[model samples]
Target: MNKMAKILLVALLAVVVASCGGRKKLQENPGVSAEIGDTTSGIDPEIQAYMDANGIVDSGRYNLSDPLSNKTIYFEYDSSALDPESDMIVQFHAQHLASTGGSVVLEGHADERGTREYNLALGERRGQTVQAVMSALGASNSDVVSYGEEKPVSAELWQNRRVELLY
Candidate 1:
């Protein structure tokens, strides 16, 4: 009946109500259990299969060749702005590097549309952007390298303009 006792009683009632609300929701939606649903369930079926076959779960460590992994961060024509998906990938790898204490090489490449020197500078800039993200996420043991127009993952111009992380 005292102020302190009343406050404690109200707090206990609030906790009980909150706990009961969750229990009722769980009972109503028993099929949506977190243990039953996987994080990779929303990904591409092919990518999911590949991850399963390779024993790679949704642990944030990327499998480069997997389409869902977003390993290679592509740049728009001459822009180095990181895409949301690629930014997530960089953050994931940055966390991995921070925990593992291993060195990573950020290899930057550009399409053959520009002059060799210009492409080299562009590639360097892209690599530096990725390095900056990594540094922000506590990755210090990283190296940036520019392939410029010398290296192209494929004949496609879009594919060429990318920064790949080598761990």
Candidate 2:
């Protein structure tokens, strides 16, 4: 290879190597940060009631509020429409913003009672419902997102049904 090309290749390699080693030339990346609290240990009271009504326990639940789950807001049956209840849920999240500087993800979920794609759409709507509330409450829209997953509504996986507020 020519001298100029060789030098450029070396520079590229060095940049890659530096990035692998955590070099800060390109801004060492800003600060950083799940689904639910550890249900295997126990569950929060409100979450427990949510689980009980749905015939699931928080134990071993993925998205259920176990200890430190970001929190979630569930929509009415087959509906993504927001309500007064969702308002209170977003308020707590607003407080969370004051303590931590981080982006948030909203996961939308639906009970496995419909087609996978349809359920997924319903789930996304569920997440969007909450995301709207958060954005309305002053949270940045760019930092929030939701995925529609056909998660069961048992305390076991019900945690997955509600919008997952992740950081």
Candidate 3:
């Protein structure tokens, strides 16, 4: 064979050998499957503890429309601080993301009382706060976006100030 052909053949052989080793390891670990269908597996202890404490069950999947599943976290007017209930909701989402290796987009919105610029910044802060909590809980793939006063959920001012978790 020519020199180029020989080099290509050697590279292909190496890749095949590496792939076979990975397959062997998966086969040996009967408890671990190739697909991540179990939310309890491969989770950080801290995250698991938080889930247990909050009584948040990981059913291996997330349903946004479920009544128990809280997708929106409302904040107090002009404040980004998360209340106890919001904190719990964030914890649940963080645990799910960490366990499933899924991604989430945190959309922040603010009340229409403030200037557009001010509201946008507040919205961003809210989103970042949620992102920080999720990251601390081992959910690494998260993005934050600020909609500010541009998007309001309801006529009520309280409903406008919120962060929504989108998976």
Candidate 4:
């Protein structure tokens, strides 16, 4: 074979080998499943204690119509404080988490009216505030994330300022 042709063949072989190795790695680590079990049979003792303390009844299965299904809570302009309605929403989620021992991600967001850095800090503060309330209500596992003004749900500024709970 010509030298140039041999070099091209070798390069193609290397590319194929690298791609196959990546496929092998993906097959080896298939990642965790997203499916949740239907029954709450083997809950941790501490979680059970928390459920009892919070007066949460385990109905064996999660209720699709539960208040925790309401994932988003709005905030006033430049404020991280929870109003009465938001407080009630957070409380409901906290009770669900305590009962199910499930983790939650509090994603904080802000409108595009402020500096990016300031908005990011405000978003973080909002998420942390929700996390604090959840923890105080016996829900332990939570993460606070700030999206700032990067993700907007609506053109209206009031609608854009919000925190979303992700399970």
Candidate 5:
């Protein structure tokens, strides 16, 4: 191969190897339990008892129709502050965690517009923002992971700049 082709090949190989090193860790959800909550909490008492008997706690009154509960909280370009709507959703999630004594994992992501390192830092900041809110609301066991641009909600750049909450 020519010099440029050899260099490109080596760089591609390095990315593949590095990504492989962390693939297993990402795939393993070691402490995540099975689905344990209903989408809403106003079920009949009989059904609620059945659900509780089966270890499912009601996730409480989050407005799924609300933009905030859409599960993808977006950020402005290069900014990590939660918008008012997203902030409400974070508060709801924090309340659930505080009440149930379960854990939440905030998976931070970024659009594919910036350098990988910058995107990674932005993603981490977004996750940390959620983590701070959760802690302040008494969800002490929250965790944060920055996937940066590695995980995209869509091909659209704006859609990718988000944090996904997982429990």
Candidate 6:
């Protein structure tokens, strides 16, 4: 192959390798547990395959209409600092973002142990953190949004600590 072709091939391989499933610990819910809580079931198998091949676990199209609960990227109890576990999730979206040709929203939240302002800033920081990683990975800047703590998945005050990715 020519130099250009070789470069393209290598890049593609990198993406594929980056998609491999990790060796780190993971919780396996044998089959359809709550169905709603079954995050893996929601993602398209093809997408999941691609993600797995690229080292992503929770970053693909989960039929939003199917009642699939959002994949929660947890943080330390009272902080929005992106936990190391969240990197894989962020990476999956970043790669998918390359194919979508559009923007994404990174909605941030806190786990409920902090003051509102701290939570807001924490959320934004979480959002911005995702934004930065996505940008670094492959996504464009215009594709990210940060809705800090304004929207909660549950009415109960305890459900607000989260950072949701809306693509």
- For residue 70, what is the lDDT in candidate 3? 56
**lDDT scores of the candidates, listed in order:** 0.65, 0.49, 0.67, 0.67, 0.63, 0.53
> Worst 10-residue stretch by lDDT in candidate 6?
21-30
Residues 1-167 of candidate 2 have per-residue lDDT tens digits of 35674355335433333332321211123232121222244444544543344355333323333222335666555677754334334534543442243457777776655567887788777766666655644555424344555445465444446776765
TM-scores, one per candidate:
0.60, 0.49, 0.61, 0.61, 0.60, 0.54
lDDT (Cα, 0-100) at 155 in candidate 3: 91
Q: Candidate 2: which pairs clash?
A: 37-67, 56-155
Candidate 4, residues 74-129, lDDT tens digits: the string is 78899999764465457666755665688989999999998999999999999998
lDDT of 3 at 108: 97
Candidate 1: stretches off by over 4 Å: 1-41, 44-70
The better-scoring model by lDDT among 2 and 5 is 5
Residue 133's C-alpha lDDT in candidate 6? 71
How many clashing pairs in candidate 1?
0
List of clashing residue pairs for candidate 4? none
* Residue-pair clashes, model 4: 0
Candidate 6 per-residue lDDT, tens place, 15-128, comes to 543443320111123243444333343544444554455454552333322211334555556665654335545555565555445577777777555566777788877777
Overall local distance difference test of candidate 2: 0.49
lDDT of 1 by residue, 1-167 (tens): 35674345334433432443443343335376552223334554543443454355664433433222344777879877776445545755665566557688999989999799999999989999899978865788999999898988798888899998876
Q: What are the candidates' C-alpha RMSDs?
A: 16.0, 18.3, 15.9, 20.5, 19.4, 10.2
- In candidate 3, residue 136 scores what lDDT? 70
Name the candidate, 3 or 6, with the larger TM-score value.
Answer: 3
TM-score of 1: 0.60
Q: Which ten residues in a row have the lowest lDDT in candidate 1?
A: 60-69
Among these predictions, the greatest lDDT belongs to 3
Question: How many clashing residue pairs, candidate 6?
Answer: 11
